[model samples]
Target: MSTLTERIDIQVKSRHELDEQLEAAVRELQEAALHVRARGILITRRLPGRYTAELSDHVPFGMTRELLR
Candidate 1:
């Protein structure tokens, strides 16, 4: 039997350019206010609820409270 491993590669132009790239990425997320998670080069998205509210709407207050744990 053989096992397969998955890997992702991320390429950037320069270290100093990282801030600019992050800013652009944040702007994109804020414009839609969706959850964004990145691992290596893989990016995942979590959509918001149907109700129009602030980012807090997506997460329950109790969940946020427990997150302090």
Candidate 2:
């Protein structure tokens, strides 16, 4: 079990773009196929044209954290 706390912010014009980038980021992070058990993607938008995407720090193994709407 491992924990990933680092966050990456994405700036896009629309939610669709954000979603696309967010999934890409997640895929990029897990691209190595290191068996990161707690692989989770958290998406948050508290500012305009900016979205936060990060691997959830407390996600249970074999499950992903729910997106923060």
Candidate 3:
């Protein structure tokens, strides 16, 4: 049978491991946030005409191009 001290030690070790894992998860989240922020910045800077050009390439069979403009 495990003594009280041993049980306490085991619990402490488990808690420490959990804390480390939590820290790692937090770091990953922070990195992902930075990536998302960078992508948002890029999206905000897109040329306004780019959307029309992309849409023009995929116009439906019968849709008049003038309608879009």
Candidate 4:
């Protein structure tokens, strides 16, 4: 399976703009045609609820967090 983690912040004046942005994003992803070792997809969205920079570490299954340090 493949996992996609995305965080998008919006401060748009109209709903139509949001819809258009979403459509463009979807099309971009589809055009990329990403390669995956597994057959399924998993997506996670994290909205921090406040304006702040975020960080992420992509560690796959069977890996320990400490190993990264």
Best by lDDT: 2
User: In lDDT terms, how accurate is model 3?
Assistant: 0.27
TM-score of 4: 0.35
Q: What lDDT would candidate 2 get against the real structure? A: 0.62
RMSD of each: 14.8, 4.6, 24.6, 10.6
lDDT of 4 by residue, 2-61 (tens): 554233343344667655654554443333323332222112223322121111234332
- lDDT tens per residue, model 1, 1-68: 63222221223556555445544543443444323322122222222211111223444322211111
Report the C-alpha displacement of residue 35, candidate 4, in angstroms: 3.9
Model 3 stretches astray by more than 4 angstroms = 1-13, 38-69
For each candidate in turn, the TM-score is 0.32, 0.56, 0.33, 0.35
Q: List the residue pairs that clash in candidate 3.
A: none
The TM-score measured for candidate 2 stands at 0.56
lDDT of 1 at 7: 21
Candidate ranking under TM-score, highest first, comes to 2, 4, 3, 1
lDDT of 1 at 10: 25
lDDT of 2 by residue, 1-69 (tens): 765435778899988987798788667545422356555556677577777766665654334354545
Best by TM-score: 2
C-alpha lDDT values of all predictions: 0.30, 0.62, 0.27, 0.32
Candidate 2: regions farther than 4 A off: 1-5, 32-39, 66-69
Whichever of 1 and 3 has more lDDT, that candidate is 1
Query: Can you rank all candidates by lDDT, best first?
Result: 2, 4, 1, 3
